[model samples]
Target: MKHLLLGAAALAVTASMALAGGHSVVRMGTEGAYEPWNFINDAGEIDGFERELGDELCKRAELTCEWVKNDWDSIIPNLVSGNYDTIIAGMSITAERDEVIDFTQPYTPPDPSAYVALDAGLDVEGAVIAAQATTIQAGFIAEKGWTLIEFATPEETVAAVRNGEADAVLADKSFLDTVAGTDGLVMLDRMEAIGGGVGMGLRESDAELRAKFDAAITSMKEDGTLNALIAKWEVASQF
Candidate 1:
């Protein structure tokens, strides 16, 4: 009886550990510069759509999440090198990216890209349109006659346009609408709608975690939590 009791206690401990360790504390990556998606405020803290979404998703998944700011160009490589367990920097789901990292089902669907000008009457046609490298917008810009000023992240692109260093910028419609009220900026025109949507990135081995996140996203969408967030952020027009 004593031996049997000891064996049962050992098995219980092992089972507890397995259950406790099943979920990982995922490190989520973001660009500290993309506004309405993820960006650093004047207070030097990260705030915006993606950050809020990450918080909500973490709550729904019942997992601990850490946010890490990284350059857009390095976001993927960092994921590949195990620097982050996931990325939530308004990253679009694309076949090219799937070749390396796994992605959750897209949470935010893509909207039309738009151009904005800081100065009135700029008369910009061959303006320098900014987009992050390796994005669908980059491919679209490559085919256009306008000068393309590629940036390491969307934050830099917005900054360039605000500083008058670039005539205009091409970005998601939500971002454009968010910046419209800022001094010295006006929307130019909405471009073709890009159909791809944003998703969280995970390592191929972290399929279980990805499944949890996808389920959480689906629930959020179904319960109107995601739409509430978009409304709270004042980005509903992009939908």
Candidate 2:
């Protein structure tokens, strides 16, 4: 009888430890400048679709989450170096990127891509354009007679255009909406349909973590929570 009781206690302890390990705090990284997806506000607070979605996923997964801001160019490297566990920025899951980091099932659908002008009379047609390096935007720019000015983040590219350092910037349609009516920028032209769907990035070894995130995202989509959050961020119309 004593042996039986001892074995039961051991099982309970092991189960408790497993549960504790499963709920470990997850470190999530974002650009904190991709508005409607993730961005830091003027008051230095992080807000947007990805931020809210991260919070919701943490709640559903029963895990604690910490949000970190980093340059978009370094986000993948940081994750690979263990600086962050997951990426919640407006990162697209592309075949090229898959060679480095794993991605959760995409939560957002691909939105239209556009080029925006910084000043009036600045004909973007056949002018140099800026976009975040290694993105689909760069490929699109390569097709045009436009020289590519690669920035570390979308916000930086937009800043360059706003400051007249670049003639135009290429980014998602929702980003154009967010930047419109500010910095005297206006949409120049819409380009070939580009995929800008957002996903969570994880290390290749962290398959379990990726699974949890993917499951949570699927649930959110099925129940309309994802759509609601998109609407709250004022980006649903852009999709």
Candidate 3:
């Protein structure tokens, strides 16, 4: 749960920048803070499951691509504003987001949402839940009428729970798993499945580009390479 809102101003930019020899240079946008999905490594370069997958997809599509790091809250807007051509971040494919931008065929299966808290017996239903703003998890919490605390980043949500600002922090299981058992945090028993699986976000006008990446994703799913990467990164369930 991370990307959801966008403004009409985002529709201003129409296409990506072109490189020499007429080859399209695609700028892949991402929230580089989500580890295992995308993040900055010790070398100060973008490195993670998405970084690897995006590179492979570009090679398969025969497109020259570069990674662009953007804040999670403005990721969608930046993409629509021509700051980037595609969002390779671990964005869930949801109907709400589909109305603003196109999404490629999902590369990863629907990841289960989990609640992590300091106390194992925390009453999640009535407890104050922390979620990244504009994410499906945040929407879900609000829809449930539960006390919801919104944070700008995933780390902030977890921090809220740690600091007693919230009873629990709800987020993707893959992300929670990394922090569980550290700093007295424990994963709760309840798990909720949210959204349709994660995919590449593209502009509606980039149908041709979407097709290229979709084809590449289909090939990966067929050849078992995508599953291999999923297993390697342990981000989500494989296709």
Candidate 4:
């Protein structure tokens, strides 16, 4: 439940060293908790839009890749520490994050941040907002000087609202769609656009790897494969 507005700055200070690179198999790190973006399936394997897209990207890059599920709170630290080679999580590209790590051209377009609450008329200005820790939504709340409560995972944020611990939960609209309008929860009409878009996170020293994935993503965008995947996942509007 740490505020990324603060944690991201700390990350920039400490994440100065890069891990030695020479691995034959590239590890793709993800939360595996955010569905439609990345999640653990019935087979207990990583499956979702990023999983599908990442596999194809690896293929195009001619690199062997494997998926690694890491906690969202330490995803970036682990990547810089060489626990993984790349992050394929649904992480928004931001200036604060860019200071600590490198990102490829966005594969997914910018997604709208939305608030979901039990009642449609919740006064957002005075409302207690719940958001997943270290996310753009949480940072946005902190930046706005809103009454913010953060949780370790996306589910916890929704739970905070359902339990009356918060007035509403703010998160990615696509992520909220799976739960919005269910169990008396409704997504508000208002939306906040935060961050640039979702992209692959890499260590600053991994220029070659970053370039490979960037090329692959660019090719996907040019060929409309990326748009097709976006439609299939309903993650965001297509480019």
Best by lDDT: 3
Give the Cα error of residue 88 in candidate 1, in Å.
Answer: 0.7
Runs of candidate 4 with Cα error greater than 4 angstroms are 1-21
Off by over 4 Å in 3: 1-3, 11-23
Q: Using TM-score as the measure, which candidate wins?
A: 3
Screening candidate 2 with a backbone cut-off below 3 angstroms (N, C-alpha, C), the clashing residue pairs are none
Cα lDDT of model 1 overall?
0.70
Off by over 4 Å in 2: 1-23, 118-123, 143-145, 236-239
Task: Give the C-alpha miss distance for residue 198 in model 2, angstroms.
Answer: 1.9
Q: Specify the poorest-scoring 10-residue window by lDDT in model 4.
A: 1-10
C-alpha lDDT values of all predictions = 0.70, 0.72, 0.87, 0.85
Expressed as tens digits, the lDDT of each residue in 54-110 for candidate 3 is 999999999999889998878888877778889988999888788888999999998
TM-score of model number 4: 0.92
| Tens digits of per-residue lDDT for model 4, 110-194 | 8888899998998897899999987888878888899999899988999998999999999888889989978899999999877
lDDT of 2: 0.72
Give per-residue CA lDDT, model 2, range 139-163, as digits (tens). Answer: 6677675788988767788888888
